[model samples]
Target chain A: MFQTRLEETAAQVAAHLTHVLDGYPAHPVTDAMRYAVQGGKRLRAFLVMESAALHGVDPQQAMQAAAAVEALHAYSLVHDDLPCMDDDDLRRGLPTVHVKWDEATGVLVGDALQTLAFELLAAEQTHNNADVRVALVASLARASGAHGMVLGQAQDIAAETAGRPLTLEEITALQANKTGALICWSAEAGAVLGQADPTPLRTYATALGLAFQIADDILDVEGDAAKAGKRLQKDADAGKATFVSLLGLDGAKQRAKTLVLEAEAALSPYGDAAENLREAARFVISREN
Target chain B: MFQTRLEETAAQVAAHLTHVLDGYPAHPVTDAMRYAVQGGKRLRAFLVMESAALHGVDPQQAMQAAAAVEALHAYSLVHDDLPCMDDDDLRRGLPTVHVKWDEATGVLVGDALQTLAFELLAAEQTHNNADVRVALVASLARASGAHGMVLGQAQDIAAETAGRPLTLEEITALQANKTGALICWSAEAGAVLGQADPTPLRTYATALGLAFQIADDILDVEGDAAKAGKRLQKDADAGKATFVSLLGLDGAKQRAKTLVLEAEAALSPYGDAAENLREAARFVISREN
Candidate 1:
């Protein structure tokens, strides 16, 4: 049931994105923008949709917010892959934006995609209430800005230059800010739209986000580069600290499992209706990619 | 009056920025963000404030929008100066963000700053009506995204790589989308806040934006590096087609003057109360640096 629903949500979000990106004047940056946003797992989209559904928010209205998070996620990946940052050549088995085009195009595409995220969220159709739209915009800005993902990026960069690996607590905080911020936003978005208490979803996302990062660390250490669609073991190569390094592989696996349990527990208030969300939490720690 | 008001506006915007930036964790990227945003002429900020004033919006409310535009502008400049882009070492007499910090910091700061711009505008203090805030966010996104400044930037880069100069009409259109989009947004912002018809301010900004770009072109030809505080004449040196290249130096000056006149004329709807805006148009054409 979860798999079918997740796949359905991804398709719907992708179609909506195609519609939104339609009619861009065919320049390389525009082309690159489209290309960069094309393929992501859309886990964020599924989270948004599932959470919104759990809260009785119309999925039609939820799709835009879903697309917005995916777009924002795509922008982060594009920028993260730039030579000045991670310097990866491939994303999802294809050339990264800078690799396919030029560094300039990568920068502009990421910038433009970020702008498009806000644009989508601010559209009136996304929500009937203006306050809701504004809330989405403001919260998203906080989630993605200097205080959020960018801050985490800065911390990661600073850690690299400091000639030392971070402690376990530091890595946890870093990942929480970096990957977890957007995940929290994605999970909480439906409640934001529905004007319900975000506490449960927020709790679910906290554990889910941390579990997701641990899974990535596990994948980096043991997963195939082809499956991951980018370089693997980059943290080890850069002498960076990660859950797999701080906690033993087995220990990391155990911790991720525990997080999944916590995430599942957070959804108990929604009863069996949140079955997909519980499945999602389990999937985070278990997915190879 | 215009000079004092502009200075006052810059100071107020600066102070507000300082407050917004107050609690950021002391880090290189945060420090670089402050440095990069500092010391620009604040022309866009002034425009936002003055236009909001024209609509009788509260100065306190108006300052956030002003700061938002300036933050957005700062982000544009930072990314534009990267090695893959314009690669300038200096900006406003200080080392560019990349030079002062590192390429990673430059990219992150710009990304964060752009996020901060939307965050500031979406703040409840920035407007009373949620719809007004949403309008500001949407308009800004359009102005700054693939359709607007980024499109213009991509065109400029493509023109350089094409190994041929753009025609006069092409450059005009490019500049309109690039500089004019943001300028138009800044000018029309007050009208958006006031819920007034933005026709006249839109017209005023169209001419002002073109005149500003023309002045930039003129400065590229004749302004001193010392006063300009960045490399000058790079356009002429690269054989890039500019207003001065398309029109003779005298013709470029004449064209800028005409634009100033047109810009001033568009302010007639506001009568003598728009004297500062008129002077702004004149200043665009006449300022040396």
Candidate 2:
């Protein structure tokens, strides 16, 4: 049931992105933007839809925010894959935007994609309450900007040049900002829309985000390259410290499982309405990818 | 009077940006972001402030939006100067961000600055009314994203690879999107905040924007590099068609002067209250850089 619902949310998000993107003028940047956003797992979108359902917010309304998060995530990936950054050629089983198109297109497409995320949140169709729309934009900007995801990325880059391995605690902090911030925002979005206190969802998302990162670290070490749909073991190749490197593989696995349990417990306030989110937490650690 | 007011607006906007950016956690990316936004003409900021004042909006309330446009413009400049893009080495008489730091820092700084722009507009302090704040975000997104500034940039790139000079009409349309959209947005912002129709300012801005670009083209043809604070004549060297190239130097100057008149005439609705804006229109074509 969880798998079915997740896939459904993913499809809806993809369709919404296509429909929204279609309204823009045709340009190569637009094409590159479309290409870059095409194939993410849509876990963020799933979190958004499921959380909104739990809050009784209309799925269509939630879809706007869902697509916005996915768009923002896609922008980050496209930029991180640039030759000057991660320099990856493959992503989601396809050529990176910089590889398929040119670097300029890659840069512009990523930029335009980021702008599109805020555009989606600010539109009237996203929410009838202008206050909710502004809140969404503000929260997203905080999560993705200098204070959050970008800070993590800069720390990662700084760590690379420091000529020393990151400590376990340092890696955890870095990962929390790099990937966990957006994930937490996704889980808390429905509450923002519903005008409810988001403390519990925030707690739920915090654990879930950490578990998801630990799982990613585990995947880098042990997961199949084809199934993961991109290059694998990059952290080890770069001699970077990861959860699986700082902790033993078994230790990392244990930690992720514990985090999942915490995530499940945090959702207890919602009971069955949040069962899907609980399943999502479990899926984060166990998925092959 | 216009020059003094423009400089005054520049100082205030810079100070506001500094105060806001200082609140973010310290990091290398934050350093790069601050460096990137340090200096510019601040014409867009002036437009936002001047238009807001015309609408009787409080200056402090308008400062947030003013700072936001400058941040967005700075981000565009940083990205445009990337090695993979225009490959510029100097801007505002200082080394470009990538030249001062590295390409990775350049990319991240630009991304974060763009996020900061939307964050400023979405802040509660920008306005007491949520609808106005959302309107600002939505309009800015439209101006800067795939449909507006990015569209113009993509078109410019396409023209380069197509091995043909753009016609006069094509260049005008392209410029309308490139430098024009944000300027128009800045001009209309006060009206948006004031809950007044923006048609007059839009007309004024459209004419003002074209004249500004024509002045840029004229400067590219025959302006002191020291005064311009950057390289000039690269457009002619690259054989790219510009206003000065398409319509001779004399013709371009005449067209810019004519557009200044149109821009001034658009402000007739406001009488003496709009004299500063009228002066701004004249300054657009007359400034050295």
Candidate 3:
């Protein structure tokens, strides 16, 4: 039941994002922009909407935040796939943006998408309070920019040639910055936009984000490449660190369970206000890719 | 006199930026972060300060805007210098960030700097109104993101392999997006923060931005690489379109004068309120490097 709702929210957010992005100028850059944004699972968007729903925020308000988060996620993926970065040729069973439109366009499209995320939030109808809008913008900027995901990417790259396997704690730190920060921010942003207090929401999102990463690590190790729709075991091949690398497979699985339990516990204070979020935490750990 | 003021503002803003960036975690990534922010002509910052001065805004407020603009500018430069993009090795008489810190750190630092720009704006205490803060954030986002500098970079890369020489108009469009947009936005942002009417300020910034590019083209043709602190005549070697490439050096100079005149005219209604800006326009066209 939760899967159906997640899928619906993801689809709606993706469609809205496509419509908004289509309004850019019809140049070669636009072609790359389209390519970067067109194919994403919209998982982050789902998190935002689900978390907002758990807080009893209007779905429409949640959708706006979802769209912005999705745009940011799309932009990061585009840049991450560039030759100078991950050098990936494929993403989600399609040619990566850099492959389709050249590296420069890929870069620009990613940049534009980042800007578009802010633009969506700044629109008059997103929130009536200007302070709330500023807060949302600040939150998104921190998650998406250098101190957040960008720093994560930098650490990941530095890890490649550092001549030692990263500790589990270090790996967690990396994932927290790279994969977890935005996800955490997405949930908190939805709550903030919904007029919920951000302090507890942030704590909940952080734990949830780590759980999400643990699940991702497990899937990358165990899931089918075609099913995953992107390269798998690249982490192992690269000798990069992950939760699964530090903990044995069984140990990692056990840790993931613990993390999910902790995440659910973090949501407990919200009481009935967080039922969906609790369910989503369970879904995050148990689902197969 | 203008050069002295530009140098002083650049130094002051750089110092402020350095102080703020130093607070980050001390890591390899942080080193790259410092490298990206440490030095520049701070032309954008200068424009911001000068424009603010014209409007009777506190110079300190202008300094914050200048620092933010410089951060954005530095981030773009780092990303642009990556191997997948322009692939330049030298910047500001030092190795490019990618060359100094590896491609990943370079990318991350750029991302971090971009985020830091918004953060600085958000954290600024001077702008008491949330609406003004939102507008500043929105304007900077537009100038730096997909529709602005990023698009310009994309166009620049596309033009390289476009298999055709671009027309004068195409070059101008490229320059406007790549170089002019952020510079124009910097000036306009200062005015906005100063509570100056933004319409005329934007117009003035736009014309000045183009003139700045025209001057850059002329400099690339005649300036020494050592003095310019970046590669010279590489534009010609790459066959990248520019004002001087489309028009002869003399014609480019003439076009620059025309632009400066137009830029000056845009600020004329402000009378002496805009004298520094008018002088800056002339300085842009007449500077040696």
Please give the CA lDDT of all the candidate structures.
Answer: 0.91, 0.94, 0.80
Among all windows of 10 consecutive residues in model 1 chain A, the one with the lowest summed lDDT is A22-31
lDDT for position B164 in model 3? 95
- Which model, 1 or 2, shows the larger DockQ? 2
Error of 2 at A155 (Å): 0.8
Per-residue CA lDDT of model 3 for A113-167, tens digit only, reads 7777887777666777878788888888877666678778877887888899889
lDDT leader: 2
lDDT by residue for model 2 (A136-240), tens = 999999999999999998999899888899999999899889999999999999999888889999999999999999999999999999999899999999999
Cα TM-score of candidate 3: 0.95
Query: In angstroms, how far off is B205's CA in candidate 2?
Result: 0.2
**Candidate 3 lDDT, tens digit per residue, B1-289?**
7778878987899888888778776677777877788776777888888888777878777677788888889889888888878789999889998897777677667767877788777665647777877887878887877678887887787787889988988888988889888988888876788776877778888888888898898898898888888898988888877889888899989988998888889887788777767888898888766
Candidate 1: CAPRI quality band: high
Task: State in Å the error of residue B82, model 3.
Answer: 1.8
Instruction: Sort by DockQ, best first.
Output: 2, 1, 3
TM-score of chain A of each: 0.98, 0.99, 0.94
lDDT of 1 at B283: 90
Q: Which parts of model 1 are misplaced by more than 4 Å? A: none
